[model samples]
Target: MTETITRPLSTEEVSEATGIPAGTLRYMRHCGTGPRSYRLGRSVRYDTSDVAAWLAAQKAATARGGDAA
Candidate 1:
């Protein structure tokens, strides 16, 4: 038997990897509310690094009481 290795993720895959539900992911896409994503033809993808950066920004904002701003 052979095993296959997968690449990091596309946007939908990233949402699943982060346990963020699809509907919310779609809303985020619509609102531009989440991590930066790239479009490939008709598909959108997110870099793992971008997701991490987004999370770090969110945490820093919360820690600095800048979340609501």
Candidate 2:
């Protein structure tokens, strides 16, 4: 049987994918207001699924006139 492996994304990659600046992503992480992430050896890693889920949550919040930050 064959299996697929998905690796986590770096801040730069996430910035490119979401159009959010890398610095902003870092700041968000510091403020605990960004997508879920984890530390992998001294680097922060973000799971693709978590990013998608976070984006969805932000969209929902915005639609409901809640703080989307």
Candidate 3:
């Protein structure tokens, strides 16, 4: 049997994927208004699934013509 492994994304990768600046991501994280994240030792990571869900919510909000928050 074979299994697939998914790894968490780094901040830079997330920024590239979302078109959001890394600094903004850091600021959002500080303000508690960013995608869900996990901390391991001195590094921060984000699950691709969580980021996808967050993006979906943003699209839904945009379609509804309201703040994504």
Instruction: Rank candidates by lDDT, best first.
Output: 2, 3, 1
Give each model a TM-score. 0.67, 0.83, 0.80
For model 2 the TM-score comes to 0.83
At residue 32, what lDDT does model 2 achieve? Answer: 99
Give one clash count per candidate, in the order shown.
0, 0, 0
Model 2 residue 63 CA deviation in Å: 2.2
**lDDT of residue 44 for candidate 2:** 95
How well is each residue in 1-69 modelled by candidate 2, as lDDT tens digits? 996768999999999999999999999999999999999999999999999999999987778555568
Stretches of candidate 3 exceeding 4 Å from the true structure: 1-4, 64-69
**Comparison by TM-score, 1 against 2, better one:** 2
Each prediction's whole-model lDDT (CA):
0.76, 0.95, 0.89
Worst 10 residues of 1 by lDDT: 3-12
TM-score leader? 2
- lDDT pick, better of 1 and 3: 3
Residues 1-69, candidate 1: write the lDDT tens digits: 896644546766877788888778777978998888777677777767788898889877777544465
* lDDT measured at residue 37 in model 3 versus the true structure, 0 to 100: 88
Ranking by TM-score: 2, 3, 1
TM-score of 3: 0.80
What is the alpha-carbon lDDT for the whole of candidate 3?
A: 0.89
